[model samples]
Target: MKNSREIIVDILLKVEKEGTYLQLLLKKELDGFESLDKSFITEVATGAMKRQITIDYIINEVSTIKINKMKPFIRNLLRMSVYQLKYLDKIPAHAVIDEAVKLTKKKGYATLTKFVNAVLRNVDRQDIILPDDDLSVKYSIAPWIIDSWSVTYGPVIAEKIANELSANRAKVSARINTLKTTKTDLINFLVNESVIPLPGNIYPDEYLYLNGVNDIASMKSFAEGLFTIQDESAGIVSHVVNPLAGEYILDLCSAPGGKSTHLAQLSQNQANIISTDIFEHKIDLVKKNASRLGAGSICAELYDEKDIDKFVGRFDKVLIDVPCSGLGLLKRKPDINFNRNEYHIAQINATQKSIAKTAASFLKPGGSLVYSTCTLNKTENELMVDYISALGLVPDCTLIDYVPDMFKEFVSGGHVTIFPFVANTDGFFIAKFKK
Candidate 1:
């Protein structure tokens, strides 16, 4: 059987070669490794991906041969080994180097095994110098992403935003079901099993900074549907919507049902919520979450947003959490930075405008429409909101000032923008409007 290091190395190579998401690919690779804990596997995979740019820089700086000219497998192997040496403090440096050398030799790269060992040794002895002033290194993001962020948030805030995205993300957070159990009861339950959870300010249901509970799906509370894993920022959206019992609500573009489920829960499962998504598979996800949360009022459907005539003036409240460039979530999904571009941004903005317009069509006179995205780009957030307003749908500005006291820190110019660094949650933009 392969050891933990070997499994991690193989996973990293697949991620580097196939451009697969590290989380999904690593989960699949480690599925059968029952003896290995999920946390350890997550650490290895996430650590390697997080430090990829720095690893490539180090490899290039030390190698006698050009890194790009090296075989793909060899380059990946070096990156994995170097990541372990630099980040896994529990592992002895000598053992990391020795194992890497052994792996290189066994792979028939005997000619380069000595070179690999020498390079790692030199790296261990020196303080790594990253380009702190360069936008790419400072943000630990690709050049294109840094440039895009600068255009969106301005250079100074963009630099801060980029720096935050590169930092270690907090553990997954979840909102405990008050209908089933209290937060204290849930914390005590997790504590009995060595997991620690803390209170979150974003909502009464939220618990933040949870650790040692990576396999939360397997926990008794989770299986019993006593809680649902959601980001604090997302939970805040449902609060902003503030659904009431018996109200007719529409969740436009709702899928994977994060906010919709929360809306149902907040309404005591008494609201009528028509949850719509563009894809059939995602509609199923909404149904599953609603079922798990015991929220039967959330009706899921697959429908295109551009065709709003079917639901014109139907809902008392509407949530338009449109698709976006996902810039606000860079810390959680680093790969997006590597793949997204200017053209993609423009396309997403157009989509956001279309969806916002369609969602507005469903809101009855004096009804509220909440617009949101997991992105910081003005084109996706503020501009989209402005476009909807230009159609003669003005927002209740007083409502903006009345954002829950818990989220006062995130409110800016009548909109809520959550920064990952400041909020310890995914970056999000939220605005509420009324017709």
Candidate 2:
């Protein structure tokens, strides 16, 4: 049987080699492990992936062979080992090196065991220096990402963004389904399950920040759909939409239906909600989440956002939580740190503009539309808001009322970019407009 370290290395290898999402693979690979082992595996695997750039820098500083020249297995193994050595101070360096050697041999790299041992030993003894001038290397973020943030948000905010993303705080936000359970009741359930529930800054009455929730799937309340996992920032978008009872709401590019289902709940299940996504499988996820949450008013459908002629001007409210570069979710989804780049941002921007345009067309002349994204990228957030407003939709400054007083300052001209540090939630953007 593979030990926890081996499992972690396997998980990291797949993430680096195959672009597997670290979170999804962890769920599949961690089954049957003890809680402690599971935690270790998750931390090391995720940390290695998050700090890949920094880890590679450390490796190259100590080793004659650069990380890129090494085999994928060796590259990831060294990265994981370096992460433990540098960040996980609790683990002894000798033990880490010994395990790396053993794992190298086990993986049919017996000839390279001595090389691995020597390189790791050098890393342990070397007083490695990070390039202070290169924020990308210091933060393990790509250069393009660092440059974009620095230019858009300025150096201080950009560095804070990097720091927040690297912190990787473990907190899960759960939104209570008021139609089924009250906040007190859900807190009681979470307490019964040994999960600590803390008050959420945004929508505290309907939201809780959970800790020690190892397996949400095992929680009876979760299976029962008493609440759903959603970032308080995401929950804010639903409120910004402010769906009303008996109104028609169109949620374009909606899948897994977080906002759409929340809209149904906010409307007390009385609104007619059409939630759509291009992929049939993603649409199925919307249907499942809506059904599980008992948001019966949500109608999940497979439809492309680019083609909205059939439903133009037919809805009282329209929500376009368009796909973004996901830079804001770095703390939650660290894989995005390495996977996304400048080209991806440009491609997504066009799609976002198209979706925003189509979403405006979907709204009636007097209807309200909320455009949102879980990203800190200005091109995707502020610039997209500009593009939408240019299409003649008037910015609705009243959106400031829907958010908490603390976030009100971020609101300017009906749009706000919620920094992760400011909100203690995902860095999100919200813009409300009237067609």
Candidate 3:
């Protein structure tokens, strides 16, 4: 069996070669590991992934062979090792070097052990000097991302966003399934199960900030439809919709059904909701989540855009959590930093416009529609808001009145962009309109 460090190297290499998501890969690699080992693996792998560019910059400063020229195995092995030497203050330097050397020998690169050892030692001894002009190298974000954010938001705020996203160990937040259990009852149940539950910064009554629960899906409470994992910022979107009992709602592009399930609970499981996704597998995910959360009122369906005429003018509220560049999710999904680019953003922006046009068409006259994305880009956010407004739907400024007081400062003109640094949540944008 492979040890933790070997698993870390494998996770990093797969991310680079296969373009897989870091979190998903890490989860798959973590089964059967002890709790402490799982924690260590999670920390080092995610830390290394988040700081890839920075780690590479430091490696190139010390090694004769730049990171790009090294074999994939050697490059990733050095990357994870260097991450420990530079970032993890608790680990002894000798231990990190010893493990790297042993892994090189075990992986059949015995000849390169000395090379790995010398580079890691040099990395430890070298003075870390980051570029003053390039925030991307320092913050470990893609250059275009940093530059675009700097132009959209000021350089200072953009730097702040980069620094915050680069930071490790994002908190996990979950909402109680009201249909299955009350908040008080769920808290008692979680306490007995050895999971620590704290009040959330926003919606403290409904959401709990969870800790010490490594594998939430394996818990009996989760299987019993007691709660669903969601970020606090994502939970806020359902509040913006403010669905009431007996209202008809359409959640276009709902998958794994976070907001759709929340809307069902918000409306006392009385609102008629149709959760639709383009893929059959994703629709199955929505169905599974809805069933698990006791949100049986939610109807999951395969969405065919060509058959749009049936959904037109049929709902009281429409939610299009449109697919985005996922720039806002850097802290949780570090692979996004490596995978996304400007050209991809432009392509997704057109898809966002198309989805919004369809979502607007779903609402009845005077019905409300909420357009949201977990990305921070203007082209996918503010510009898309304008495009929807041009469709003759007026911006519903009253959405601000429902926003929690903690997030009120971020709201302007009834639209809010929750920056990770400022709002302490995923970087998200939301705007509401009436058809």
Candidate 4:
């Protein structure tokens, strides 16, 4: 078996050269490893990716070779080794250098092993200086993202968002499945299982922080459909829409069924919900989640744009959690920060507006329409609200009493912008309206 360090270097090389998502690539490479080994690879790989700019900065300052000019393998090997040496204090510096040298020789680059050893050995991590004035490089986020956010939130707040995004451990939140069990019941079960779970500050009744749990899905409570993994921000959208017992709810862009199944579970599996996505395979995922959670009322479908005709004026609440730049979720999915560009954000904004417009026709007069995104871009959040309002929907124009009192300052024009650094939740924007 390849040691953990070698496997991490191989995965980081692919991530740099081929552009695979960090989590997806790690998951593929880590199959069947003991949990401890998997955890170590996850740390170093994600750490290196999250702090790509800073690691590259440290390497460039020390090495004669420019980062871009080196072979992909050598560059990634140095990047990972440097990340551990600088960030991982538990592992002694000599041990990190030793493993990196061995891995370099085994990759058929025996000639360069000493070269690797020399650079790592001589470079003093403390001497490395990050570009303090250049917020983009300091945080390893693309300049466009920093520029866009800085334009709205100002430079300081933008840097704060970037710092939160670069944080190593992303918080995990889950929702109790009310269909099969109560929140109190689920909490008791979790405690009995030796996993320390606590209610979330935002949505205490429904969402729980997975405090001491490492592998959540493997828990017996999870296997029994007692809860499902969901971020607190995403979990709150179901409450914003607030389906009553038999109301019809439509999630126009539902996929992987997080919001759709939550709505079903919230209604005790009695609400009528049609959860559809643009793709067939994603709809299959919704089906799988609905079945596993026993949310039988959630009907998953391969969406047909023409189906809008059938759904028109037929639902009580509609959730257009249309996709956006996903800037809000950067902390949880660090690869997202690297994946998006200016054109991609514009393209997704157009698509988001298009979906919100179409979803409104599905709501009856006076029916609630919750427009939301895991994004901070105003063009996609507040401006989209304006477009939907012009479509004859009336904005609620007040913060719901249940919204975390802490975000009172951000509650403007009936919408809330939750920043990860500010709210300790995934960055999210939510707007409620009545058609």
Clashes of each: 0, 0, 0, 0
Between candidates 1 and 4, the one scoring higher on lDDT is 4
- Over 341-387, each residue of candidate 4 has an lDDT whose tens digit, in order, gives 87887898888878888888888888989898998887888888889
Per-residue CA lDDT of model 1 for 231-293, tens digit only, reads 887776787798998899999888899899888888888899999988899999999988888
Candidate with better TM-score, 3 vs 4: 3
Residue 312 local lDDT, model 1: 98
Instruction: Point out the higher-scoring one by TM-score: 1 or 3.
Output: 3
Q: Give the poorly placed runs of model 2, Cα more than 4 Å off.
A: 304-309
Q: How many backbone clashes does candidate 1 have?
A: 0
Candidate 4, residue 109: lDDT: 94
Ten contiguous residues with the weakest lDDT in model 2: 304-313
**Winner of 2 and 3 under TM-score:** 3
Candidate 2, residue 348: lDDT: 94
By lDDT, the best candidate is 3
Question: Candidate 4's error at 424, in angstroms?
Answer: 1.9
Worst 10 residues of 3 by lDDT: 163-172
Residue range 179-230, candidate 3, lDDT tens digits = 9998999999999999999987777888898899888878999999899999
Instruction: Note the residue pairs that clash in candidate 4.
Output: none
Residue 351 displacement (Å), model 2: 1.4
Best TM-score goes to which candidate? 3
In angstroms, the error of model 2 at 394 is 1.8
In the order shown, what is each candidate's alpha-carbon RMSD? Answer: 2.4, 2.0, 1.6, 2.0
